[model samples]
Target chain A: MSAEVELQNVSIAFGNFYAAKNVNVKIGAGEFFSFLGPSGCGKTTLLRAVSGFLEPSQGKVLIDGQDMSGIGPNKRPTSLIFQNLALFPLMSVADNIAFSLEVRGHDKVQRRKRADELLDLVALNGQGDKKVHELSGGQKQRVAIARALAVEPKVLLLDEPLSALDLKLRQKMRTELRAIQQRVGITFIYITHDQGEALTMSDRVGVMNDGELEQVGSCYDVYEAPCTPFVATFVGENNAFYGKVEKVEGVKVKVQTGGSSFIGQAGLGLDKKNYKFKAGDEVIMFVRPEAISLKGNSKKTQNSFSAEVKTIEFEGNLKNIFLRSAEDVDIRFSVPSSSDTSGMEPSKNVSLSFSQDNAVVLPTGALALD
Target chain B: MNSFYKKNGPVIATFFLVAIIFWLVFLIVIPQLYMLDLSFRPNLPPLLRGGPDDVYTLTHYKHFLYGSETSKDAYNYVDIGVFLDTIITAVLVTIINLCFCYPIAFYIAKLATPNTARLLVLALVIPFWINELLRSFAIRILFAGEGVINNILLELGLISTAVNFIALDIALYTGLTYAYILLMIFPLYNALETLDTNQLEAAKDLGSSTVRTHWRIVIPHAKAGIASGSTMVFMLTAGALATPVVLSSPNTYWFTQLIYQWFNMNDNWSRGSAYSIILLVVSVTFVLLMMRLFKVTIGEVVR
Candidate 1:
């Protein structure tokens, strides 16, 4: 019921502009893989390529080791859930779910039976007789899932299908989607720009930027050890320090920026390049906001700086403290709501520090902000 | 009504209301009521009007079923046959126009680029700027013997003799179809333009072929437009006089030609009015039947 999907040097170009550039990844059978990137970053284009709506201009797409060139969407063994769901408004829920079966010449009884089965699978039992518009937003989402699964496709490709839902429904659907994927044991290729969705639901995440897959790794690995400045800033919130490397020692590099020095681990460059640190290479040091602390001293932390607290934003579970360094560089760090905040006030002087292992130093190329 | 008066002041609202009333009463209702009245009276001589012979009767309506009692069969087969022929031909023309215009409308609305769509619309509309009479005459000349098409075919050695297109009613059908093509196309285009293109891709991705996709999705969604276009084309074609006269051969006849002859040649306005009233009733019934068949409301079609 599941198949391995592999892209080998695939590039899709519209005239002179490449929508997807030389993307290569092998999604194993039954794997829940996700492509995470911002808008216009080629994630949707890559998903379209896999679904056979788009043909790669350069290389091959293989499903179960079968070359998929010249195969149209109708002949492919994959189902695509569009961003807007694209359910047939003229049809009942049963008919919408059974559309694939109907098109394949199945009789009405078989289609209805299979449609009901799929509805039950999606936890929408007995909703088959209702019109598509009669269902709630979340129910419609489930109907789309049921319709896609009715075909029993080897691969299910979703192009930000949950993006239109409200926050709570989206969260609930994410878990349900993960559970359904495991139950069916089919390959699921999900495309989205939300880092939370990718981090929580996907077994492996591919971070894309400017038509290029910048990083492909597990959620934990991508968050903990990003190889490029784009991935570091794009995958999560990070305080980036523009600096020059002062020295290299073992796996750690010391960088000096804004009259302040920090030591962090060296990171690799883009996919194949082995970026080495030296005494004069310009770099960017990234540290997650949660990794920084206000109380740690120089003896306990490797990098220490004094800054003036600008503002303290109290989110329900945590408080985000905005600060301005002595050199006027803006910094932000988060503290748990349970932590003591007696000394933390607006415009008050505070000392902040983070351990070296929590920060990463990489050669700057393209920042996600740019 | 009150809101309209408030929005546009009393003077403007009253003026608009008066103008609409005048137009409806004088232009539409009055003329139709006069014709209905005349249809029930005998076509007596002018001197006999308001005399003993001037009386309301069903004689004019009965004349349609039995034109002249002097014949042996007395069933008025020619008139009835011509009426049925006109109806069947109009239906054929409607079906042909639908088959031709559906793809063109879909292409313009969905497949063509915006620039190409604008150009195509311009091309379709530009020919309609000319009078329909002239367009019908042009089609008549094109399909006539030794016409442009036959001349080309002769030059290419494709035909040994000239084809009698008018005798076959091909010229008439072509003229009628061309005359009302825009009426069919615009409505279909308006409906198809609102269709989300993702639905097409979704159907294809679900393994539906192009034919099945249209049968199951596109056609069902465009039912209102189809009903509207079909009704307009059928009514116009059935009631048409100029196209049939210009494009018909010696062997062809149209029901409107009979009505025209009764009014002008026989000086029998009563019979003409009766025939026209019947045509209107039948056309309205056909429209209602179509609406019922398509499962659409009048509001949907009008919209």
Candidate 2:
């Protein structure tokens, strides 16, 4: 069972402070959506609003074209997997999964049968009789999922449920979660601060900052073409250049910083008319670490700069080269470990350049560092 | 034992151990043993000790079950009725205190803000600062014939005549409930405070109603606290003497009062000790029954 959810100008305020301010988005039925943000950025608040735990102060939450203003969480067709999993420690795995059915007046046999089916769905066969504490961390996570799914909710909301696991288990769970979502074909609204989780699992990602949704787009669009300065820096690592626009040419803009001049394409926007760069406007140019390369090695080099090699970090598949520009700005770029590295040494002068399309220039507002 | 010495050093550890042993022997164990011994002997004069008539027997214990042989009834219904009444009243008091305290404890622990909870706890504790005897007397005055409640009811025309609350045993129940209420509240608050609130939210999010959430989750988690609180309240209410004496009318007869009469008024220490032993056995049985009902061990309740 799946239903579309729409938030129309929803804002939740606690006294004067708005935890979620004017959020508006429609999640497609059966689509896996993720809200990505740092802590206290209102991602969880918005999820709560959809699950009917919180009432929006301003607008409406419409689920399947029905207003859910006065409905409590129990009446809403939504289930939440809490951050801590919140499995009933006093219950066996079967009884924990069967709790919703039990509350709906189902007999013990029916509940047990449904619980067994859900356990099989989660691939935890023969685990129904064990106590919650007897299960491992990953098993507990599955039991929580089965419990949420037993209610047959239309939308399943997850509030960083995998945050407590180790790195390896977390990665494994991510793939399993995506597969499970597709199999059930219900709308899943996942809230997390981890960018890797948001990028890898969600069909579309909503980036939030300080109670406002900065941008909502596909993983490729958010990573390759971020509309705002915050999204570019928050989503991934970026090397930024503080400068003023010197020339505006169609979709390409030239920026001049101290001791260097760079040309990059203008930032993308949902509405192109509202986002434009002009001469003398202050802006920041951002480039991903993998974009920069040695000068004269590629055909599309339009901007170039000289810097000294600072340090090289040898990661498993890639080597990260750090450099300091003539103006003392630190820059970093990565090359595959299999590439030649004979002459790159600390304090050696090197020329670095990137193509225009790989870099984006946007009007500086709020950077993730700030 | 060695850890104790290592933690506290030899001299201090030895001092504490000796003190505990001395208190256990002289204060508790010896008195209980003396009562047990006295309960099995015959009630006699001072000069009869070691004489042929002075001997150990079950006469005093038998006296509790049957009155003098000349009595008409087969069993002593008056004393037995009073004993049963005392037990029923104690159970009722425990039930009433639980019903009153569970919601208050939950509100203080989970629903109310920290400041409001602190203020509520302060309010609950301030009244208990007054002596229990004075509080019981205050309750007696409030429920008396010409008391504040009766006067208000009469003035408002809710009743044409004053109700006999004391004769109806309402005043005694109220006084006992008031006296032992804090014992019930604190244990429940301690248990409920440790409950992770995420569990409650998870239950709600899973489409469980509020009442069902408590039935399946909250009350089950608070079993240890309920057992401990109920056992303490029942025992204390059954053993209470002053509150019943202050609040009861002339018609009311309490089991403790019979024990008091046997020991003091009638100078029959042996019969009083037998009744005391019986009450002790019943209280212990009630505690065991509470443990069984809650499915908790004594260790859990103590914790």
Candidate 3:
């Protein structure tokens, strides 16, 4: 039901501005792949290139080991669900779903029967006679999916299709979308800026920035070990400390920063992914909040530091305690809200600690936000 | 009206409401009533016009359908024929204007760059700044004997003889279509501007060919605009006087030209009022039929 999609140095340019610059990646058949980036990062451009709405300025887009050059969007065996869920408002639900088949010269009976089957598949059964406006936002998305599926496309492309939905429905639809994709067994290329959606739904997530693919890997791999400064900050929240590398020992490096020498597992600090590094290199160590713990969780082998508490953010199950060292270097860690965090108050002093393996030592690069 | 006063207080609200009523009655209602009254009276000479002798009759209306049968002269089939011709031309003009304007409007709204779209709108508008009468005469000059079109065709050897476009109906439509085309383009542009480009892409990705995409998606979404533009163009083309008078040859007449002749040349204000009323009725019917056909509500069409 699905096929492999590959991009070979694909670049899309609008006159002189590069919307997508020299991108290369491979998506497996039946793989749920998502391109994660902020707005204007050219993720949508790359998706459009695959769907045939955009032609790459430099390289090739291939599907199922076949070159897709000179092919129009209609001639390709693919379907795109739009950001706004572009369901046909004028047509009945059945008609909107059956439209792809209708244009293929199918009779009304066959179209109606197929539309009804899809209606049941999308869980909107017996609601085929209603117009698109009569349905809720989630139902409209289902209709759009049903319509796209009616063409029996081997690859399904979605351009931020769930953006218009509210948080509850969006979370709900995320599970539904993954289920539908699995049931259909088609290659799905989803484009969005929300890393939560990309992480939750995609088997593999491609982090894009400034018209470039920063990193492409499994959700856990990218979130756990981001390769670029942009990816580390953009993919999820991480507290960073700027420093210079003091020494490299095997796969670990010790960074001297803000008058404190911190040790970390060396990863992700190079001009290019393949570049090597040495001592005295300027770097930033990024640590996830979950990686740091209160002094109780710190083992004898870990390093610890004392800092004054600045703010306490109480999320339902976890309390985020922001701390600042004597040198004014800021760091934060999340502790289980039930674990006696009552003392974690503003202006209160506390000790934070983490193992060297959890802190990623990378060459200083761009932060997620200015 | 009471709510209006409640909302804004008594004095200013009453003044505004009464002014609106006064304007409607004095400007729109009174003139329409006067025309209706005049239309029911028999046609009389200029000196005997508005006399007490012949009034309150259906004779003028009957004369429009049967062409003054009580007269001691040849049967004037021209009036009734032109009346039908006016309707048919109005419909044809509407259709033609739609065909010409839809693609341009869509391009401007959805395809062209914003600057290009602005320039194209200006292109549609700039010619109208030249007085409409002069534009109509320009059409006549272009299509008349030994005019620009004739000279070009002669030079290209497409035809050895000069084509008298004025005698043909083409000249009148060329002018009227030009006159009313801007009216068609604007509404369609307004409607199409609201369409999401993603919808068009989604249709193509759903395996719809270009024509099918427009047929099932674009046109249905733009029905209100289509209805609005078509009705306006049809009514205007049907009631237009300058094009037929300036561009038509001898023995050719438009319904407006007949109204003009009845009022001015024939010295029959009653018959002319009847003709004007008939044009109004036909125009209203066309508007309502367009609204019905396109499934557009009054508010949607106006919007």
Candidate 4:
């Protein structure tokens, strides 16, 4: 029911620009994997490469250990749910779901039967007779999912399939998509820019930037222990401090920035930085906003800094407090606000602290500016 | 009418209303009413016609369909057969235009690169700038016995003798198909261009081959374009006067030619007007039928 996909040094180019460059990933059978990146970062390009819509400029894609050169998308054991869903507007729900079967010359009875089964699988039973336009957005999403599943593809590729939905619907579909993948037990490769969806649904996430896989790991691995500044900053909200490595003491390295020195775990996770770092080497230290606390000078953590509370954004249960460092570097941290909290006035100094274990020190790479 | 008057103030609105009234009365309404008047009168010789003594009747309409297959009467079975044949030929021409333009439209809309697509658009459009009469004349030259096509075929050893292509209505079919190709392609291109390419890719990814993708998806998405294109091309071809006359021999009798002869050669304005009315009725009916069949509103086609 599932197939392992191995992308060996895949590269896709358009003229002089490589949309995907030297990409390598080994997705396990039935595993839910996600490529998380910003727009135009080549995650979709890599997915197209796996789906055989795009041929790799160099290297090859192997499914279940079989080389797939010269194979087209129709012949490949893969189905792609496009960003727009791309449902056939002319076909009824049943016909759309049974399109794969119908094209293979199956009789109406058999195709309808298969379509009904898929409709049931997507929890859309008996709603197979409606046109695609008649269905609601969420219903259409389910219909698209059912159509892809009806093909019985070994690998299901989703290209930001839920991006068009409302926030609440997108969140709801994330859970539903994961559950559906679990039920079908097929290898699902999802591509998305929304970090929340990727982290919530993927068993392992590959964070990409500029056509390169910055890091590939579990949600916890990507958040708790990012391998690059790009991954650390891009994957989630990270409170960063631009600085140079002051000293490396075994597992701990002290970074000097914003007229303050903070100590964090040295050289990425496992103390293995992608590039070697030494004292006085330029580095960026990243710690999650949630990891930083508002315990002023009385904080016990070794990693602490004083910043002016520039702004406070109250977001439901959490409140984001934007801070300006002594060197004017902006930092942000969020705290749970169950009630109408008392004033933390703007321009008031606040001490933020995080444990050394919760922070990562890596040689600086690309930073997400926007 | 009141809303239109309200939208634009009285002066400008009234001016436009007067302009439209002038157009309707002078160019359309009066001419059509006069033609209707003419259609009900008998076809008399020019010396005897247009006088107060001339009589009004449906004799012209009856004369078109009165005779049986065995009748030895002149104009016997010709009008009905000619009308039917004209419809059939127009349908064939429309079909040929569709077949020829579908791939070109799809290629320009979906497959061609930007530069090549631009070039293709120019190629499809530039010829349409010349007069259609000239284009039809060019087709006549091409299909002539000693023409470029015959010469090429003879030199290539494809045929032993020069094929008399003009003897048949090959000239009309070829000329009409070529003449309205842009009409077919532009609308189809416009429709197919708006299609989400991901839909095609999704079909292919979902186990549909290239042909199946077009059959199930592309064609359906381009339905409005096809409907509009077919309606325009069919109407044009059916009502075409120049192409058939320029390309036809004695044997190639297009319905338009019959109408032309009624008005010019025979000085039968009544029959000519009746035939013109029929052609108008048929084209309008076909347009409506196409719109209904494609489930498109007139607004959709006009758009």
Stretch of 10 with least lDDT, candidate 2 chain A: A268-277
Docking outcome class, model 4:
high
- Shift in Å, residue A331, candidate 2: 2.7
How many angstroms is residue B254 displaced in model 3 relative to the true structure, after the best TM-score fit? Answer: 0.9
Query: What are the root-mean-square deviations of the candidates from the true structure over C-alphas?
Result: 2.0, 2.2, 2.6, 2.7
Over A313-342, each residue of candidate 1 has an lDDT whose tens digit, in order, gives 999899999898998888889989998988
| lDDT, candidate 3, A1-370, per-residue tens | 8989999999999999999989999999999999999999999889889999888999999999999988999998889888888887889999999988888899999999999999988899999999899999999999999999999989999999999999999999999999999999999999999999999999999999999998899899789888888899999889898988888887788888888888887775323342245788999888898988877676643757778999988899988888897768888788788878777678988877888888887767787773
Where does candidate 4 chain B have its weakest 10-residue lDDT segment? B67-76
Q: Write the per-residue lDDT of candidate 4 for residues B119-152, one digit (tens) a residue.
A: 9999888998999899988999999999999999
Best model number under TM-score = 1
**TM-score of each model, in listed order:** 0.96, 0.95, 0.95, 0.94
Compared to the true structure, candidate 1 yields what TM-score? 0.96
- Docking quality of model 2: it rates as medium
- The Cα error of candidate 3 at residue B227, in Å, is 1.1
Candidate 3 chain A lDDT trough over 10 residues, lowest sum = A268-277
Per-residue lDDT of A240-308 in model 4, one digit per residue for the tens?
A: 788998888887888898688888886454334534568898888888888888665234567777788
Q: What is the interface RMSD of each candidate, in Å?
A: 0.6, 0.8, 1.0, 0.9
Q: What is the lDDT of candidate 3?
A: 0.88
Give all candidates' CA lDDT scores: 0.92, 0.92, 0.88, 0.87
Off by over 4 Å in 4: A269-276, A296-300, A339-343, B1-15, B43-55, B67-75, B283-300
